[model samples]
Target chain A: MQSSIKQWQDWIGGIAAQGKFVGTNRLGFEGKTLKPNQVISDGPYAEVKEMVGGYLLVKADGIDDAMKLAEACPILQIGGHVEVRNVIPMSR
Target chain B: MNEKTLIQQLFKSEYRKIVSVLCKLFGAHHIETAEDIANDTFLLASETWGVKGLPENPTAWLYTVAKNKTKDYFKRRHIFSGKIVSELKYSQLNSESFEMDLSEENSKDSQLKMIFVLCNPLNPTESQIALALRILCGFGIDEIAVAFLTNKETINKRLFRAKEKMRMANIEMELPNSSEIHSRLETVLSTLYLLFNEGYHSSSQHSPLRKELCLEAMRLNYFLIENEATNQPMVNALMALMCFHASRFEARINAFGQAILYDEQDRTLWDEELIAKGNYFLIESAKGNEISKYHIEASIAYWHCTATAHNGKWEHILQLYNQLLQIEYSPITALNRTYALSKVQGNERAIEEAMKLQLNENHFYHCLLGKLHSEQNPKKAMECYEKALILATSSSDKRTIQNHLKKLR
Candidate 1:
């Protein structure tokens, strides 16, 4: 599963290398990571399991390229699945 | 887009969707654990993707992380007992089929069921609806606190107590039986009405109109309409009333975020489409011989919406209020009917009925009495206004009554 996710990440990273992707990670686990603008806290016996696993965002030319990149995701090797959805464009 | 804004937007849309999808995979009973894992997955995604640059399909990447997190949680939970581990493995296979069956329609149905479960009468009155709105509808405690005219600490306590009751009762996620549906539907309708009214009469200066609350109420009402057991006349009537009131939301408040009296509101600003929809629902609600308080209230509001002028027909409104009073003679109804009487039969008759009732010494009742007395005896009106000001909950309401007193002065 880890390899599948890694492969998928590499595929996505390759896309980014080609200037076809932009990535971001949403920090969901509150105390796990020190957020860019957040202050660090002292030890409160933090739980490792509660830590955030992080994410990747990729912008592609079309759905096909996105799928092709997702096919190599390391998560599938560890018996996990990926969910693909189109982002709705914001009207500015 | 900038990295921070892009990440924020992506997380906002995907977080709920991913959590919802995973909850089904890991039984609804294990929702808290599922939520924790989903949170962990997003954190993982943030770290990995931020430095590596975004993946081709960000949603897919997040899902992958979430699924792995789910597996880890199950594995840990089953670590103590071998028998539980085997059972977990069995369920893991079953979950694959479950994931395949998770259609859009099913998800919506699940959400609707969650709403009902939250509003269950078996739960404590104080926090049942509030907790449900928070968990099921994503409303924050602060938002609910403002709506209920209370502080966040009280709201939080209520929510905590509610969740404890749910856990103690071992409340399962399922629809109520046909026999119990009516009572359950009553609770559901009340919650939805409460939600809509908060949006319709918002107290917040920052966001005077919460369209989210209105839309959620409408959506839940639609869900009720879809279900055979809940499709009653009262439900339809309440929905119609919500639509009619929501239609006038745009004109209900001024640009400065101050309350705009119905008389001063611009009728042209109303959403005609929603009014037409409300009219259609009102007709549907009136099909049967039975009449509910909702039916009467909706009918009254419908007339107000259709009236060509502000003072078009107080007699019709008075008649509807009389019907409403017969069906449900609450203090609020008495107060409202008094206002309609003041409009139609003159201040004397209105004052006579208003004085008969023992209102909770609230500002609204005093305000009503103040307005009724203002025409005949300005001194009495001034006295009522002062009483109302003392009882007033908000500065805005006090200011309104003060302005009325100023007219007399």
Candidate 2:
């Protein structure tokens, strides 16, 4: 499950290269989340209770591919879950 | 195809709809929460949708997701103890609930009411208008900052303060009463006009004019007109005035986006349709006995629009300006009137009248003085140009004045 979760993370990181990811928490995060292609840095001192445990990023194909990718993610072993969603483009 | 385009498109359409819906479901007091939830829903969609191949009914899907998100928000906030939350929960099951209608109207009304609330004279000077343009008009902080000639951080601070005041005042999202409507309406109109002016004459280097800002302002004015209680003649007159001015937008600049003087512009490129619409509004505005400043301004624009090569009637424009001055005294109007007077009665009288008035030490006033003095006294013109260059806020304006000074030299 850990390896699968890592695979899911790798899939997301890969998809994110071609897509976008948005993060939100009921609790405020230290600094803003990085944009797509922005390198993440360390040492903001994340609160143990408020750390982001999972993420999602859109890719081509469909949710089937998304879920298939998520199935391999490492988080599920540690009780973390990934939810795949499709974004609806805004109408002009 | 790309994530950026997708996100942009989503924001363009669903951003308002989702925000409006969420704002209604939540109370006016929890608007910030509602906005956050709406934004979160979009972010979620952006992350998930690329792999999902998009939804069949994206808007409906978003609405459902937002609704669920709002419920989660309430749960997290522990707001379910209130009778309002119980009522919302009870009505949630009934798909055709009256709450839906009320909520829909409430959202739009909240935005409209916010415009007035932000523009309240008791608030920070001109900052509320800037705030409303940012929030209500959907303008970016950078855009608002540029419009007001302030830094983004300053604009952000002003917006924060304005919002804090609203929260402290516990301002309800209710429309003003008839007696209070006129005063509130003035603020709303001014905010819209400010937004339109920013778009009409943007100082940004990359894009000189942001037409989107103008269109958004006009859209808000249309919304104002739709409200039965708010549809005063002055509102109509203002709308007409904007339409008339916006009609000439295409002809206002050349391909290079340099400022095209009125006399130099090609009249053929002006949008006749917009002019006609403006005239229609102007005629509608005259139905009542009271004439507003908008009526006078629209009439002046109409005169300019209808002028032909054989008869570019400056007298009619001057008359409108005279009527405008009687209604409201502003230095900007005086400056404009002086220019028309120069065209009709000649430069000496125009210069004499302009010289008497004490304008706020601004670059435009000095530039006008420089132009007025250029023909008669090159030395004086040079001095005026130097003052204008010193005071100029925009690089383009400064460059133009510098060129004028160079010519004089």
Fnat across every predicted model, in order? 0.00, 0.00
Q: How do the predictions measure up, each by TM-score?
A: 0.70, 0.71
Q: What is the DockQ of each candidate?
A: 0.00, 0.00
TM-score between model 1 and native: 0.70
lDDT of 1 by residue, B1-409 (tens): 6555655555545554555555443334445665577568767877877788888877677766776666666557664134333333235453223232235676565655666667878765547657655665555568778767789999988876776676677665667787987778888888777777776766665454277677767877877887776788888999899888988888977787777778878999988998898998999898778787788888888888884746546767766766565444466666777787678768997787577455747789898888999888989999998999999988678778888889999
RMSD of each: 30.4, 29.0
Q: Candidate 1 docking category?
A: incorrect
